[model samples]
Target: MSLSPAFLDELRARTSLSALIGKTTKLQKAGREFRGCCPFHNEKTPSFYVNDDKGFYHCFGCSAHGDAIRWMTDQRGLPFIDAVKELAQSAGLEMPATDPRAAKKAERQKGLHEAMEDAAAFFTEQLHGIAGADARAVLEKRGISAETARTFGFGFAPDARNRLRTALKSYGDAMLVEAGLLIQVEGKEPYDRFRGRLMIPIRDPRGRVIAFGGRIIGDGEPKYLNSPDTPLFDKGRTLYNLDRAAPASRKSARAIVVEGYMDVVALAQAGIGEAVAPLGTALTEAQLERLWRMVDVPIVCLDGDAAGQKAAMRAAHRALPMLAPGKSLAFVTLPDGQDPDDLVRSKGAAPMEKLLAETQPLVDRLWQAELAAEPLDTPEQRAGLKQRLADLIRPITDASVKYEYQAEFRRRFDAHFSPQRRPFVPFEKRTGGKRPAGRSGWQPALPVTEDAKKVHAAGIDRVLAKAVLAGLIRHPAEIARHMEVLGSLRLADGALGRLFEAVVDLAVEEQALDSTRLVTILARSGLGDVAGELLRADTMPYSFTQKSADPVRAQADLDEAIAILVARPEVDMMLADATSAMQSRFTDDAFERQVALVREKQALELRLANLVQANEDARALGPEEN
Candidate 1:
């Protein structure tokens, strides 16, 4: 039975050399490698060492050197096949099927690997040769030193498609195509897949060249291109620079995920060496779990833009469903419109370091994403937020971890949505219809004026919109404070939206406009009754007390109310669309969509109810206690 080289490599990688050696002899950590007395012979000097990085244990005392499998066979007196089987079981690897052609397959793979290595060397030579002047100039412009270029094995693939095929005639086109160095199509000759671009050799975890990535040096569509999935490479499972970054991670206790391979190279060039990138795909579960094997919390340094933010959210959402105790991702959003490559190039290493150091937890990022995705002023919207949080948390399979997350979410919800206390405790709830003592321990009571502003005749959305408009009118100068948010808002009431826009336009034109002046301007716009109704004390959904109604606080609260007012209509339309879509017979895709929409509607309704409840929390106390 011929064992495949990949299967053998898998077995070796999964085996802990130190553990295999330690069972028979004592071991001590000596830097990256472990040291122990030679188990092969009697010696106290300790000339034995197991190098996990190298995947072999060696003894100077006796010429004993082998990997976990060899040690099992040599020292434990097990047959070769039995040893491999035992180790495979221990490492949780399935045994490859026995095949008579396995030896030929393995030989072919070795040839392909050698061919790729030779191709990498040729490309590197081309980078240094006179033919690579343009590539070298681009390198110089990027500040990649000769030494750095050599370290990253930066190279150039010439524009001539047949250059590689001609030079590598020894390997022939068949193996080249198999190795992905040449592209093969029906009725077409094999040609180079990469040409006229900067070349990057992608290696596997064991530092073997399995694939290649190319970046266009000039105007091009993709900007960056990677090898397609082949027998030798799976883009989704491989990180661009893991072979170096894995060892580097041992020193830094962190791994940085960036957008492109060049970002990794740039960070490595800048002395921040612990960086890796997914091969032309969004961060996946396999990629994340691989990182977790290296560090407790990997830093996901994303580009600071809308697209980057969306990517971060996708990663966060994927991670939420797989979270375990002491395992998660930290997010570092680069400055707006900048990637690691851009940032490191402009600001050098310090700013990148600062951003990496000040990382945000995955949970906080998740909350921010959902919270900002929609308005939460209405009870339905707020409830929607809570429900989204729950859906995200429900994926935590670990009971203790799930419970702790639940508690944290509960605490946040309470902080944002807890019922406000009445100015004075209600007589029946506090004293069972009995009069309570005064503050000075005396039985004195004074008639209290109810906050008549708490009641509203209009719908909750309309009430909140009126309160926001009233706040803006009452403190016209404060309109500047929320102009950006107000301008962006799409109020559920069309008339209100138009009125709000006019108010903003006036605010910009007349900065010093006061409440009376603003109302006079609106009266001329034929929105005088709307303005009048909004300004009435009875339209206020929540009691913004004389103190709380200061320009700054009112502006903030008014913004929150406006968010709710705008969100309700958006939710209604979405719900209606979703309901209409569900009228069709349910398929797998439709079922998922229906479930998601129903869940969203539930949360929205809950949020609207919560906002209403919060407003109602302000009570009408008949008498004040002194």
Candidate 2:
């Protein structure tokens, strides 16, 4: 089968050479290409390389080389047709039917390319002629040198209607209309589509003029206009200045995206050659993919105005679903009320270079955009912010990148919303060598209080203690309700006491506390091990300890457990005192008191036992009930 060059070009553009060659060889990134040991010959060091941007593979050691089709036929031992078939299938493209019409279509497209080139040359001649005096003045006013204009193939469209129609009349009116150079109506004659405008040719990767972008010289409704999509041009898939920018990007190890063709030209004039621009539209997925083929992270430098920021956000949203490891976008916002063109004109290229040097990653820009979307002063607004973030990251297809983004967003959310902790200072330093206003200079050192001694004497139920602490950690919102009662209580285990104190302090510090943020804070404070121990599945048989338990039910059960825990020590202390009094002086009242205290302690223990049994039943019923 004789395949058309158009179909073959599409195949090459769609297939990633690195990925195709990587199946048999371990290829590591080496600048703009991938390098690995030569698969064609025995070698210890890497001498083979693949350049996806150029769609070719070369082996320095064995001189083995090919494109995707060559690799499939030579290495995989398949025929030409089979190789094309396999690549077409993988690229989600339909195999072109065996027909002579496809060849004719390709020939016609080649003719259209010739027509576009002729039109470009005609416009360039007109730009240097007498009719282009106004165009030259416009370029001069914008600080574009004659040399720069010549390098970029700057041109002009005369204000008259038939200037191009008469110049390129040999290509026929049909070819000119097909090339998007002339507009045709039902009965009216086809005239030039661009008039009284400065022209910039849009070229393909091979430097063939595919279309033109025209900027109105002065006083126009639309300041800029682009050619309609034709066989040679798909605006969404094309980036302005890509033919020149690709090689420059490979050398710089970076690529930049600006808002307009003029900005790209300005940057190029300033010796910044690795810059391109979308064709008067928001950045698209095809353009982003094209950029990634050149560099790992391309910098998108949009204007700093509201529309520019919105355009940047749109680009970010377009990139999220396609993000892969080491393949993402960075962003740069130019100074206020200025674009790359304006900045270069005012302060030269240093500020533009500095901004590019310090570009923000896609994640930071996403966070800032969402944070500034609305005021997060209310609970509802804050929750909306988190929900928006979740929605934004949900589209990320790469598992590892998605996970990292989630973790980073969570960390940022906690850092932004959680209150800052005060730095610790010694009491003497804080007081500046003076006693507190209400306290005497010399205060008595008190002995171990009665409550502390009683807490030590009454051995705690280890299982119940774990359950209560875990419940509090899982449901941090309930901490404030029980803070006063818990403040006066003491635990015998030093680690457990420290954990309790930390929890209480966190509750006091953060107004909006969640379980994840609470655990994160505890982990940062070196209480992670203790917290982890308490949160173990086998450590407690309680609904509140389960992570997926219902919030209302968890809070209620946690409250009951806390009540029982707090009242137990008092019952134990009263019981001990009554028994001691009875032993000291045998009396009926003392005996009665000891009996009542014993009954109260038994009731508390029984309640604790029932609560555990209820939790066990709930656990057996599964998470629905919990």
Candidate 3:
């Protein structure tokens, strides 16, 4: 039972060597491949490696090497035919029948491959001939050297429609047409598909020319044209320069994805050989998988213009669902209006190298793209941003990775939209010992006296402070609503002040702040003693302090406490100033101001007393009534 090479190649491409070997080998991802102990021999250190991209397994210990079928035969002890049949069945491939027609078809494909090679040879000859002087000039203008041109198999397709057909007539017109070298119609005779253009050969993994991409020499509507899908090539699965870049990527431990073939060539010219490009389309899943096989994180270096950015985002979204642990993409945004090719030409490869070195991970790029998708000023727009982020994270198949992405996005959203306050500073330090200028010759109100400081310090109720802080911890969602009021008022107790600041900062940074996580983070930040004291059972009898407290009533009570706390400081400041003014002038207006301050202070005290009384009454009523 003989199988065609095409069938075997397709089988290898479809079958994942890692999944097959992992059944017994316990493989772990190591860079672009999976590594485990060699199953054929006793070894604890994991010398055996499997590469699904290349569809092969190798053992450094025993020097065992083969592909899917070989593994099935050697490891499973199956004969060649049985192994091939099993692999074919698993790969969803029908084993090729031993028939005359099947053999003829395989032979025909072989002829097609030969025909494409012949066409490439002819194009290369024409590029160096007098007829290709213009093409050579184009290459020179684009900084393509003669050696690089020859190495990449650069060639020219003359303007004449019959030039390629005439040169390769011995291979038969049908073969050339089937190979995508000539255009055939029902009524019209077959003619050259690529004419008056510069030709670059597109090859497979084994470095065999499977197709050609042609770029027009001068101004034209469709500047670039690629060969149509033939039996030998699938454009969506093919990447330009992959044949040459795979090994370079292995050595460099990275791969660079550019937008065009010329960019790959330019980077290669600049001595960076691990670069490839999609064949005239947005990156496909197959293409991305191929890139991941070469390196865990391939740097997608697209142009920095609007269209290019849009293309980069398209690649990112396409890759989201396919992301796995240790397998993802990184992106490099070239200088504005520039590409890898342009960057290399202008400033040498150093800038391009730097950009590649500092590539942004796919998640970061996705966040940035969605952040810039629309304005987040309105509530609806902000909700849309959150919804979009959720939508992006929904496609990720890995549970752990998806959870991490959700956390990261939530953190970013909170940081961006939540109100952030500067670190607290002393008034003297903030003012640099000089008061800010106000209206000319109108000095600001005098500072509070030492007596007033002592009065205000003694006025802060520790029980009230602990109750408020505990309530916030219990219902962390209410923290955002009270952030503005809480930010303005300073807690008088040192431990309480640090705890309050930590809670506010946590609310600003973490959108999904549960009581447990809030408390845990606070404890980690060296506030464990303060947190424990605040959360103690006897800390306060307020409904908000209890775990079973009604969120609505608790929030209301918390808001009331916050209002009283904020008002107290304002009243103290006003009363101190009014007292000073009365002592200095004793005018009717000043006396009235002092009277108003006294009344306001009395009202705030009454409110605080009533709040404590209401909580105690609720506590007496028990959890059901409260």
Candidate 4:
């Protein structure tokens, strides 16, 4: 069996040299190629290079060079025939049958090439000829320039079926039929296959015309038509504009995959020359392999229409199972109802360029696509979402890449449904514990301003509440231990209440916030001014809130202040009740109650008096404490 040159090129194009060798030798990306220590020789620094573009592995150190077939034979000890057979199978190519016509494979291929090229030239000339004026008009209407038309070999097949046959009779009917230019019916003459359509020539890697694609000139069925799978053309294996795109991709460091030939042509016209398109089918794994040979991550530009989004989704799903580290796809969907052609024509190229520049990664697109697939409100639904994510992750071919993707999903899952802390709520009037947890109190600071000397309008309770809140901002680490108790406190100042809630939320969200980071986070969350005012030393002359301040003394002052604040409210209620009873016609029991209430009020007043003296003493010793 003889393998044709076209088949060999296809085979090599379908293979990834880095992957083939990387199975055994560790490899790392180096720009457009992969590099590692030469597997053939022992070396410390990497001197080996495997270039997917050139389809070969080379060692600068040991002077080794070979293609995949040769690597299999020399590196893996496979025989030549065995290597060829294995590669053909992997590339989805069948071994040619050994027939008497096998020896004339080259001649037969040459004849097919002559016929296809002739058809392409005839189509072009006719497109320029008198009969092709309508096709030329169509091109002009689509904004296809003369230079682009010539560069891509735009042409139009005559409406009549036999017009091309008459023009290319020299290549003979048998050759024309074999080239897929004419379709044959049983017991009937073959006629031109593409009729009344604008023609596009598909070229091989070396820029040889291998097949033709046609777009109907006007309203018709089968909007786009491609050449059948002939000896020279396999639509599934071919990407439109790849011959030009491969070289262009190297310069831009990006390969773009669109959905159609006009999309490719439109981008090239807009100065984006690295665009390609699958041949009338969803992007295939083989085509993806070919794209990776040019650039690391190629971008898939789809239209924003529903069908376009579905196409983008289809490509993403096909790519998921094939993902490896440093090898994945990026996606950018154009505006609704706009393909690349429409986008460039309507908005110029800057918008499209900006969109491509900000293309999302594969995993992000995956998360977004799957997340939007269904609503995740219930536990079962959320868990199902996780399972969907895991299902997508499970297909990743690389173990390390799979693990990292799993980790990414795990992070997203946590962010979505982790135990939600109570939303940041402003402090409200509330009754909590009647006493402090311990001797919670704080240290005193040097009076920062005359403002600090102002007496609390609500007296020591307000002063103490302000003091405790300020201490937390100075020492956020102390928050974790007293979150519940602090959460229960109700402050009189509304702004101060909001600040308290924000600080508690911050503490709960981040368990290990230091004073600096905590303050920064709060400042970023629109609380900079609030935090500043609440934490200002000038708010209270006797407040201590510096790195050098004693946490023990701070807790002591805070606890004592809390106990007094909580107990003061109860005392007021008792005094009010006793005062009410004493005001009414009272018996001996009511009289006793009044005496007891008076005693309680006196005791509470004494405690408040001591708190005043403690503040005075703290103010006096503030300089010494600092």
After superposition on all C-alphas, the RMSD of every candidate to the true structure, in Å, is: 23.5, 14.0, 12.4, 20.0
Backbone-clash count (model 4): 13
Each candidate's clash count: 14, 0, 0, 13
**Candidate 4 TM-score to native:** 0.59
Q: Score each candidate by Cα lDDT.
A: 0.76, 0.84, 0.83, 0.77
Candidate 2 lDDT by residue in tens digits, 255-297:
9999999999999999899999999899998899899988989
Against the true structure, whose lDDT is highest?
2
Cα lDDT tens digits, model 4, 95-161, are: 7777667758767997888787778888889989999999999999999999999999999998887
lDDT winner between 2 and 4, please give it: 2
Top TM-score: which candidate number? 2
Residues 420-492, model 1: lDDT tens digits: 4334334356667755444223221111112211211122355556666777777788778777777776555
Show the lowest summed lDDT stretch of 10 residues, model 4: 439-448
At residue 86, candidate 4 shows an lDDT of 93
User: How would you encode candidate 3's per-residue C-alpha lDDT over 482-600 as one tens digit per residue?
Assistant: 87877876567587888989999999999889999998999899998888777776547566787775565567668878787667766887788777776655444665566666667
lDDT of 3: 0.83
Instruction: Rank by TM-score, highest first.
Output: 2, 1, 3, 4
Distance from true location, Cα of 86 in model 2, Å: 8.8
Task: List the candidate numbers ranked by lDDT, top first.
Answer: 2, 3, 4, 1
Which segments of model 2 are wrong by more than 4 Å? 14-29, 34-49, 57-95, 422-626
